[model samples]
Target: MVISPPEKPTRDEKQSAGRNVAIVALFAALGGMLYGYDTGIISGALPKMSAQWGIDHTRQEIVTAAILAGAVIGALVGGSLSKRLGRRKTIFIIACVFAVGVVACALAVDAWMMTFCRLFLGLAVGACSQIVPTYIAELAPPQRRGAMVTFFNIAIGVGIFLANLVSVVAAAGDSPEASSNWRWMIGIAVFPALVLAAAMLQLPETPRWLIENGTVGKARVVLRWMRPNRTAAVEETLQIWAISQQEDKESRGGWANLTQRWARPALIAGLGIAAFTQLSGLEMMIYYSHTILGTAAGFDAGLVVWSGLGIAAVYLIFTAVGERLVDVVGRRRLMLTLIPGSTVFLFGFGLMFVLTDHPNRYLTLALMLAYMACNAAGLQAVGWLLGSELYPLSIRDRATSLHAVALWGSNLVLTLTALSTIDGLGLGPAFVMYAGFNLLSFVFVYFAVPETKGHSLEDIEQSLRDGTFLPLRGNIASRIGLPDNRITTGAAAD
Candidate 1:
């Protein structure tokens, strides 16, 4: 059955398709923004909630950890929903949840009510973390995939930065009316939620997913919109069709597939990275910088709130930097370079706490910002990207579900125990413990993680089947026998 391939697309068609992909990716990345705002808002709102509700420290911890509990459940269930409903629909559902949950939180009358509302909101947060990167990765071309998927990460930083900025503004006045400002902080997320829901209604399903589901005709249409021309679109659609058929014949895609010997490396890398991302203590800083600074470090109230704003800015800036460098430097090398610096900065931050009850404010702030730059640019940037890209297509949805569970579960444990840990061990020892975790993360990456820069998703899958996924030989690209052009710009012309 020989057939002629379609002609290459015209220059105008290529430019148009590029614009379509970019627009879609940006709209979908709004899911990440909602995830960030909903989760990060709590840090600033919690103190106000405590002041208004007269909740004790134990109750305050419960309120903060509530959403985390729901996130675990959301991650657990997101796999089935994504597989059955499709990514676009699942995201729409997540958006609706975000909208409803935020409104409920804003209307809460007591601590328990707030906990219940945030718990409900966490479902969307957890699902957004799991699904948005995968959706973006599936939409983008191999060369641009790193940057596109990272748009979700960047949007998250945007949400967090906005949350902190709002908190700073809300905290400006000292009257009793200030206690009510938490409602505004929590409620503002509804607008973005509504916006995301509207956007998802217009975006196309990823061609890879359509091919997987045996709708080659529709997949070809989608590829046309995403790729440069008719020829490129048909070629990619055929490739995906071939891979999907082969996977169907050889494997049943589900939890059981995760246990196969060939899938073990990906499982180890994806799950390990997910856990390490949370255990790095970046979330602790995002969620509790004010507590760490004001209560533990003896900073004034204004400085504490403003320090949170500074922390958020550093995260947003470095995550943007990492987006540009991920493909150029390669993922494994970038992590290796930045993680050690994170270890050093965190260690220095802890040492100051140990040395003096009143550590110099500027020194502590400097160390925190430095730690943030290293952590955000490295582990934080790569964690979600790797999770979205690492697994074989057959098991991608289920694998990402498990990845989300590991991330949210680790986060839940950390947030639940952070205040108690600090109270019991003191801030110095607690931070030192986190620094040790960063060192351990470095060791894990060096031994097990492989560089995936400039490789196609199918290419990575083939490496797994061939038992050549590990970087045990040759230069980074040559380890996988990639062409030099792919190793560089991911374009044949390069």
Candidate 2:
């Protein structure tokens, strides 16, 4: 009998070899915390800033959205920069930028100056949002990739939760002096930003990025760092290198490459998924939650604080569930399940808003919570993950950058429009608009989006090129020509 050599350990097997990947993921996730803290802090801090600066609603919206606007630019620039400078380096730069922006925000003396500072901070937040998940995805083993990248969303929820909790505590004292504590709320981010920046010094650069840049030796070193004892580290590195070389040979990997015939559908799918995710009106609810709760639901400030906390908590929980289910049910299935659920919730919430004369505060709050739960369980958790997964590694950075810009740009517009829409059309009409957007999303996903669970990046690229919108599941190992048992028979098998 011929004896066969032992099978090589795949990336997924290496995931359990040590805690290095987890540690790296944790540090990278700090960038997400800053993204969340900065965005959500404005919700509570805006009212205080408006009083101090004596700005009108329009001006206040501008201040609140200045960071988002800056993020649009940051996402575009950061995506391209990460491709050149490497993911780890790009995120390090983002951390430093965040630290600077936080300090500037804390020290601003006037509304114009504060807006200026916010624009600066927005760039950091935008860059973090774009780069952190990509970095985590690139570094993570495919088996745990979804869970690892989901940390970004988790960090975001935590950031928002902490911001709200701090704001409530800071505003506890009943006096003029107590009201200005919002500044401190915004300033607290500086500590985390600084910590994130400092921690990046110890993390390894992404092995994939290294290989893409013709630094194979460096890539091997980094791979070893991630999987110290796995002999398959070098094999996986070579496989990735082969894929990158093939991509480069076929396409020059330029901006024009994304517009080529083979890449267009992937681009459209990425951008559409991202845009529809925002169109769900989640950011609008996030930015104006306090105002909406107080005005539409007739909840007081104390109730708004509690409600905000509840929203964050529920968001975190559902997002966790979504993360676990993403690899199991596949991206398309998750979208199919969650989009209709979100739409129904939004429609009912809209009707409730329209039907009741002086709607019951608790009932309205409950409906809003239901809407948030649906969003968190679906769009918020899956959107970024799907966007990151849909594109080939060749144009992944550019595609992700474009998608981030679209999402944040839509968020900027929605944030700016929320107060106006509420003032002009009332809460019911505003929700009705979101309900329509969600309905449209349901149609788009059902028709256009493909399932990507368990497919390798290379396999996904082939599927996109072949115009197969649905994933071909089962025996993916043989279909993709990967070794049987290379990946554990777990959620990936589903």
Candidate 3:
């Protein structure tokens, strides 16, 4: 006698599962908003805080770079912390730290106190940068992974927008009392921290993490909830279990696994992309655009602060656009399409700065906006997304922490040196240097980064093991359907 397999989940059931997974991803993405808000708030607050505290350029740089320093340390320790404590718990700890750190910053009595608190706050920011996309990527199906993982990017844009809006609103007062309003800007982030902590209670541990820890039954249940149907969930569970066992036999985990021959490509791609995301000058602008515009471009202080609002608006808008484009055009194609525009726009921006002490303000604004649009849509959007997807599941936590370290460490160097560099080399030359970085980024991505869109985590790991992970002339691997792009029987597209 032959027996038919259990019936697949119905269409309604599939829809329900997808909706549930989306909700979970959205909640997790809130951590990114906290990261953005805390980091972006300083851009507007710095001018006021500097005035209020009677600080010099060196002190201001210290205050700004403090959080980045802590973020580097957070990324350094986060891999071990997340691996031992689990992703969900690590995020909860991040939320708590975010709350406490913000509160401490609000109450800081001096520049030194604020620097310490920002450093403390950066622990959450760094850890969130490492974990949120990783968590979302693990839960999302390959078909939906690009868009879903980018939700973290979208949330960060939202947070930056909110920080800028708050700054603009606070500056609208412009009274003697308004000098202290930076405290309010730094303090208001606590509510989002609270929200993220509460959301963690309802989210499940990732199926991959559970499988690695030998909780295969719970992993299957999570996959059932996260995937479209029971059959797909069961198949994925088996795949993850098999990979976990094979990896166990292959090497010891930790720094050792990352040094393996197979991991070399992912290391270069992930860490190189991470460094370029900063070296390309996005973070430098985000943190110090107001200063660059007001001091270097000779814009009015009010217009400079207001430009932060506009810059953030463009970032949010294009990041949302990139969310759709990444999945539709694929990761490699999207970046290649947008990055050249960034290089060109930045060079033009530098030319404007070189033209005169007082170049055309409107032209400068136009170039800055155009550069932001291209960078936000391309490299900035892809950097974190690639870090989350490139490594094998066995070493993903460690690899992502390294990715975050490269990102935050580069950010730290840029933050500390931006003012000094602009002062010494002239703003035009500094930006021209950034334009060169963008050009170099294009070369690196074209040669090193492979197409990862629409490929399952297990399929990517298999490619690495088989030494087939490199990109072809036009990503023929994806076009030829080498990866597991097919849906399981009775399972709907996620």
Considering every candidate listed, which one attains the maximal lDDT? 3
lDDT of each: 0.86, 0.79, 0.87
lDDT comparing candidate 1 with the true structure: 0.86
What shift in Å separates residue 302 of candidate 1 from its native position after superposition?
A: 1.0
Task: Point out where model 3 deviates above 4 Å.
Answer: 1-8, 176-178, 251-253, 472-494
RMSD of each: 3.4, 4.8, 3.5
Q: Looking at model 3, which ten-residue stretch has the lowest summed lDDT?
A: 484-493
Candidate 2 lDDT over 1-494, as tens digits, reads 99888567666656555478889888999988888889888877877777777888788888888998999999999998998898888998999899889888989998899999999998888778888988888777666677778888888888888887776786677852226777778887888988888888888888878888889998887777776454657876977887788788654747777777777767877788788878899767877787788766678778887888787777777877887887776667777778878888888777777887577777777877788888887878888887767788888888889989988898888888888887788788778888999999876765556666676665567666665643334554554421121212222443
**What lDDT score goes with residue 23 in model 3?**
96
Error of 2 at 63 (Å): 1.0
Residues 1-494, model 1: lDDT tens digits: 98886676788988898898899889999998888788888888888888888887788788988998899889878877988888899999999999999999999999989899989999999888888898889889888888888888899999999999999999888762247988988998999999999999999998888887778999899888899887888778887888798799555646788888898888998999999999999987788887788788888888888899999999999999999889788788888899999999999998888888788899989999999999999999999999998899888988999999999999999998998998998898899999999999987887667778888788778778877776554465444423221222222221
Question: Relative to the unseen true structure, what is the C-alpha lDDT of residue 154 in candidate 3, on a scale of 0 to 100?
Answer: 93
What TM-score fits each model?
Answer: 0.94, 0.91, 0.94
> What lDDT tens digits, residue by residue, belong to model 3 across residues 1-494?
99998667888988988898799889999988988889999999998888888888889889999999999998878877988888998898999999999999999999999999999998989999999899999899888899999999999999999999998888887462238988888999999999999989879998888888889999999888887787899988998888899888653656888888987888898999999999999878988988889878889878887899999999999999999888888787788888899999999999877877778888889899999999999998899999998898778888999999999999999999999999998999889999999999987887777877777877777777766666643455455423222222222322
Ranking by TM-score: 3, 1, 2
Q: Which stretches of candidate 2 lie over 4 Å from their true place?
A: 1-4, 7-18, 176-178, 227-231, 250-253, 469-494
